[model samples]
Target: MAEWINVKDIADGAKFYAGAAIRIMPTPCGLEEGNFIPENGLVYLISDNASDKSYFNCVCLSAGEEGNVICRLERKGNYVLGSEIKRMFESELQEAFISKSIEIAVI
Candidate 1:
């Protein structure tokens, strides 16, 4: 099973690569990472560098790791709608998701 995590929680000060699988919660304005628990349905991917105190730059999740995910992106070659990341500058949006399988360093 996969886990839902808050980027802010795991972002301990390391860089999250693009295409990382993650679960996120839907908001009135947009979607946001929910928590730091593993769950199924990898429905989001990190689209850009996300710091511990920053918002996510992600898209809908897909199969495989970063390499595989990148291939999927190349095949699709189009922007995913309704999957845009929000609250980039807000310091109150406490939501993030990351896979426990992936190794992360604590700072």
Candidate 2:
């Protein structure tokens, strides 16, 4: 059984969003200087099953803070309408995240 991490645990601002939670592909590096590799795991909901998967998206504001990493929405935050995922704005992503609709992974 895989563990489900609450968004509120790592990013303090995520509980405000709705859909919720993610499994991790753990990494041991710092996400700084625009350095991120998507080879790591995605922020996906186990409840959402489809031919094309949906994943939460976030921009790391600060990763140096222990236990409480800071993040905002990605410019193209993961937005799904019906079976299609769309490219949305960062603030829109923030809304989704704040409403507890999304969860972020630890870097």
Candidate 3:
């Protein structure tokens, strides 16, 4: 199995991106979220560097109270989701890059 590093170990220059929200269509089976990217458009996740991920042209969530739950884009200095990890690092070196945790820096 591949080694998974904690969110903290991610590099500072690492790039992270998110997928766009797609309107769900009601069907007999169930509603399905569209693919990460639409046809003839940029893919949500790009494995080019496989180390630093980049997110662009996507609707970023904001800090707002819609109801009881608050859903927003990742802010700086917070742990990122597993989906934000673009590359895997050596297990031994993970600790050196991070101490407590890491976050998604949107720029």
Candidate 4:
């Protein structure tokens, strides 16, 4: 099984925009280590399990602090209808992370 971290745990300076596609990364070493990698087509949702595949369309209710990020994962499809996942970091969906940063270019 893969180790998971909570968004609230490391959501101090994280940035999240609703309706915008975000990504999530997995912590191979666990939350204590605070290490993560970039994951494609995956977003952190409100859950304890880091490997939860169901909470894919979770939306961020708040923004994060500034500095080194722990993980990075991206939301795959279009969020036209909005995110299915809801809840706060300390409550329901606590397990979430941003593995890495991806650069987007405007065409």
RMSD of 4: 13.2
**Worst 10-residue lDDT window, candidate 4:** 78-87
- Per model, state how many residue pairs clash: 16, 11, 2, 20
- The TM-score ranking, best first, is 1, 4, 2, 3
Candidate 2 lDDT by residue in tens digits, 23-87: 33323342332323243433433232233343433323223322332232221234332211212
Q: After superposition, how far is residue 88 of candidate 2 from its true place, in Å?
A: 30
Q: Is candidate 1 or candidate 2 better by TM-score?
A: 1
Pull out the clashing pairs in model 3.
15-53, 16-53
Encode model 3's per-residue lDDT on 1-107: one tens digit a residue.
Answer: 11233444456555443332211112322223333222222111111222233322222222231122112324233333333332331222122121222233568
Q: Rank the candidates by lDDT, best first.
A: 1, 4, 2, 3
Q: Write down the worst ten-residue block by lDDT for model 2.
A: 89-98
Q: Give the number of the best model, judged by TM-score.
A: 1
Q: What lDDT tens digits, residue by residue, belong to model 4 across residues 1-107?
A: 22334444443434433223334434444334543333322443221224644233343322342223223233333211112222222222123443333333456
TM-score per candidate, chains pooled: 0.33, 0.20, 0.19, 0.21
**Model 3 CA lDDT for position 32:** 37
lDDT of 1 by residue, 55-77 (tens): 33445433453222211221112
**Alpha-carbon runs more than 4 Å astray in model 4:** 1-6, 9-18, 30-104
Superposed model 2: Cα runs more than 4 Å off: 1-18, 29-38, 46-99, 103-107
